[model samples]
Target chain A: MTNFPDIASIRKDFPILNEVIGGKQLVYFDNAATTQKPRIVLDALSGYYEHYNANIHRGIHHLAEKATGAFEDTRRRMQKFINAPLSEEVIFTYGTTDSINLVAQSYGRKFLKEGDEIIISTMEHHSNIVPWQMLCEEKGCVLRVIPINDEGELLMDEYEKMLSGKTKIVSVVHASNALGTINPVSDIIKKAHKVGAKVLLDGAQASSHLFLDVQALDVDFYALSLHKIYGPTGMGILYGKKELLDAMPPYRGGGEMIKEVTFEKTTYNELPYKFEAGTPNIADVVAAKYALDYVDTLGKDNIAKYESELLKYATDAVREIPGLKIIGQAKDKVSVLSFVIEGMHHQDIAVILDNQGIAVRTGHHCTQPLMSRLGILGTTRASFAVYNTIEEIDSLIKGLHKAKKMLG
Target chain B: MTIKEAQDELIEDFELFDDWESKYEYIIDLGKQFPPLEEQFKTEENIIKGCQSRVWLNAYMDGELLKFEADSDAIIVRGLVSMLVKVLSGHTPEEIASADLYFMERIGLHQHLAQTRSNGLASMLKQMRTYGIAYQAAE
Candidate 1:
């Protein structure tokens, strides 16, 4: 057996795991949606709110200085988390949705011209698709989609053929939230760059599982949510190349983002502040540093290893259930296990599981297009994290049998 | 039963279960008991706006009373709608439009509803009231 983190000891860090749901112990298998916070992360949040609760930047007061320092400290931590070349390359946003929207507006809107192409995949969440669609509508640009195989793996050949000089932007998800497929992003970035197109990797799902190095991938932009990394919600990072961000226009207009105010013209602030408009989610940002530290303390490799074990157990156990079909069978996957029981509604499965205190997400999972492509409404998705165990998978298998017996 | 009486009865039924799981199972059973909404009525126009779940609520005036037919993609949401339907359907438009659904709180269901589910339930109630108001205006 591989050397992995102690699951029992690691589970102790998350107090929410001890919670009871529907008269049973909570079995949280919805990590892909958002992860439960560790005590350290929550304590960090409480520490900030209790001690230094004030607005960041431009305040001279002691509390303000303290808050600003704490807030900026998070940015530096995030920079190290992703191994970005410069700390200023990191721009905090509300979440992944906000980060992607920033890129779509600031980068896509300003640089992309008429008849240009933006290539995405069928597996992209609505957050990754809708913004570019809006941009396409405004800029008269064409949107191309990379097709996926039955296994939910992207067709690299089709993608290569689709790329041309007209393809100005190739935005793809680093890891699919619905499918759990870890895309070959480094290769995608290289190929896109070859066509003189910039690549934006939606790292919302990957950030928690993978150790990301922006310089190594040569990726132009990356968007991810910290909450999925066992951090706070409403705290996200948008890491862009310094030169690209310096050239792109500001996303939102607010006090902190502007360098000068005049009647005729306005100049935007430097690399990160230009994109960070309005009062950011400061307390959550501070909490995010602790979340990253928690992950660092445990080690991402250990988490991934344990989660992979859970996925293996789950996949094997679920497959044993007669008439249950697993969706997205890609070789390179995270811990998401999406499946549908024959002649059973996904909602029914979800309800049954919830009754057993096994929290699983059902329905399209914000990937309606992907569901449509699969010719199914949705599937019950049980995504595992480091805190989960084989016993939970056994419970899930038993729950599935009960659901089949009751509903069938 | 009258709308208030039906709501009170529901609260009483919910109290029988000591735990949320049994109560939830009972609710799902209630949902399952309801005849599925007719396919003809499940149109985009009938779909409730602001619902996280894809819930389609359709209503028509039956003489002086309004009859509501609804469905949801979520089983729990369907159960919630079934509860609403039991209370509001076959009631006078004025009664439905003015109804204060305190039974949810009394039944301990209000606290258990997820934010989205709460919003969905609110949207369902709003749609029911909108139909009531429309029927009243027509009269």
Candidate 2:
């Protein structure tokens, strides 16, 4: 038995947990969509706006320098968090979707050619799938998908066969938002390197639960959203190899991204600033460091251990419910428990659960192709975080029983 | 009954439930009791796509009265559609286009109308009104 963090105190860190909805205590089971921010993170956000509100990187005044220092400090923290070789490799963006779009437009469009194949998995969120599709449409590149088995595990052997000289890049989710399957991204990256293909891992879900070491994995690009990791919304990071980032064109032409802008000829900024276009989400980016620090203090391994136990407890209890089938039963998974009732619509279940103040995500989960692959419309996903407890899982189980009875 | 009268009746019916649980239970029962749209009417053209649930709505003018038949894969959505049909169906196109739908708010199900929920109820309301406007134009 692993020693878990004090969940009672951890839950206390997030004020939203105290909220009452529909006359019931809020039980948040939708961590996969976005985790609730800790007080430290929230305080950091308000602190930035109140204490040091200024446009970063350009102003010479005291407030500007302070804001710039804080914003850039986040980059350094994220670099350490992900074990990137250089802080300059961490480019801030809107979110995971924006990060992927940057690579698709700048790297894929610039390098990929006709007949060049881009490989992705069937279980990818729409963010991962759509950007590459958009790139392929423009560049005349072929898009290939690695199929999954009945249990939502990637067909690695099939993926191996799919890789070849034509494979330009392989993009896949490190941990699936819909399924919670912790993908074998290390093996994936190694195989892609063999075929001379770059690899980009969507770390939106994994950053919260898994230890991210980009240098060890030799991953070329890593993208994630801060909101999913207990940080503010509208903030994300795109960590690309310095060499590749240096070679790629700028994603957007704006003030920070440009070194010199004359109508005749324009020169771009160095490293991350080249990709970070305009004034970034400075306040959210500043607050993101506190979120990461919170995770660091609690320890990722501890969080993972506790969440896994939560997943096991939830899985065992949920299996007893009649007509309820769990989806994506991968041997290696995070704390996501996705299931579908035999005769009940997921939305109907969501509505019932909502009234009980149990927030679960019920839908295709932005992974339509994955749902189609499983031969199901959607699943009701109850994802756990470090702050979540077994009692909350019990609440979810009770809510589900209520849903089953009422719907049945 | 006029649209206003039908809405008042729905509000009155919902007022009987003391708690949200019973109110939702009533809505779920209404959903289950609500008839499914005929197979022919569940075509792609009739489908109103919501992010969470799929709704099929078929509207046509029955003489001078506008008639609407709808179904949703989600029971709660179907219940909402059932309410819409009960209140707006069999009314003149002009009447439906101008009808105020205050019962949802009064019944404490206004959260369903939120765009974030995207249960298709909001879109269904809009589509019904669009149909009403279209039929009225033809007249």
Candidate 3:
């Protein structure tokens, strides 16, 4: 009945929203970790398995052709979704962690050398941080960190000062998972490129909430986890500039990654296949297209607009609660409200919320370094998506009030 | 009580709550039963390696019984640790080493434990059991 993208109908599409826990309807606020897959994306997964399940890109069979077509269809879809320069630039991997590891192992190992410096930020997930650290350790490179201010925004002036000839690569998260800070990756990319460093933006958090355009961002590399974007788990994409991907060596050397194999020398497959070794996640890849379509159908602009409202509402509501403090108040952010109660532990708050069937993520959220940087162990995180309604936010507020009475 | 008896007692305790809300609240309440781990026991060796929060567990043998003192930065995990200590401690080394945690699944608490946290929990139990086995062998 009401306009503003018909949130109720959209909520119904997510079947898990109907889950009754503790005699209450499920209120999912953990979108930053992973999103609930819609029925359409689910159907595509089963339909692929039901009709045409086969190893992609080799067989002359009909099912193979259909599957190969559908699987490749997702690559093109992702290319369009992010407005990449070429479909060949889209390389499928396990998830963001795999994608980051690919860049670190293949490109980083090949190019980076002793005394070289790589710049990362305090807010990166461990997946992003560890791979680079491993690469740095092997290559004898120095890892430089971009410091953040009290508000969780990156210190741009400090980042600018750090840019020099020794800086070989600058990798950072586009949006912080813990803080919800929308980083100025465009500026970071530009400055790093000026210093001759190839920039890799960890787009795992941003891809779900913000409009992504690799071409527009002109990033050397960008990693996305499809599960964070409402697609199935175990599937994601690594979007690299065509030239960089071509220049980088194969990540994993196995089947479907080589053209000719012999005892003497082997020729690697071109573009994406070089990185995506072995049999790819064919079923999940095919369904990922429908996930993108669902996002496109709802419209990112619309989703952002709606989610922003929810964020604002929840922020206001939580402020009214006694002894609660919001964290990560960046000037630009995406719909995530991280907070801490004065005396209550994050897990206690999380458990109490779970009791009320209002699920919110608690603890470090895989960003322990960020938590340490902020001088706190962790915060109870409530993130909003397109399907979330104000009513749900009210329930969260009410639940927190009860938590205050019990735990405070 | 036997380890099995302790687990059965926990299952009965959880069975009193029909909904996950009350069950979780009761679990949180149980955290208070755990005496905080001694400052000396909070050293790096006793810390669990993976987490959204830090958990420290220390084990020692008194006669045949293995006593565990544990603490967590997160209260809910602290509650879980308290329950584990209740069920696993005060048992003979062989009994502690061989105890099967069937009550975890029976009480439906297994579903609430994340794969990572469960792995950490499993590791904590393993550390305790390994300690018991080592002490038993030493004796």
Q: Count of backbone clashes for each model?
A: 0, 0, 0
Question: Native contacts retained per candidate?
Answer: 0.12, 0.84, 0.56
Evaluated against the true structure, the overall lDDT of model 2 is: 0.93
Per-residue error for B74 in candidate 1, Å, reads 5.4
DockQ of 2: 0.88
In model 3, the clashing pairs are none
Q: Write the per-residue lDDT of candidate 2 for residues A42-110, one digit (tens) a residue.
A: 999999989999999999999999999999999999999999999999999999999999999999988
Which candidate achieves the best TM-score against the true structure?
Answer: 2
lDDT for A149 in candidate 3 is: 93
Tens-digit lDDT track for model 3 on A292-362? 99999888888888888899999999999988889999989998999999988887787778878999998
- How far off is each candidate at the interface, as Cα RMSD in Å? 3.3, 0.7, 2.1
> Which consecutive 10 residues in model 2 chain B have the weakest lDDT in total?
B111-120
TM-score of chain B of each: 0.91, 0.96, 0.91
Q: Rank order by lDDT, top first?
A: 2, 3, 1
Model 2 — TM-score against the truth?
0.98
lDDT of each: 0.88, 0.93, 0.88
Which scores greater on DockQ, model 2 or model 3?
2
Query: For model 1, which pairs clash?
Result: none
Instruction: Tell me the TM-score of each prediction against the true structure.
Output: 0.92, 0.98, 0.93
Arrange candidates, best TM-score first.
2, 3, 1
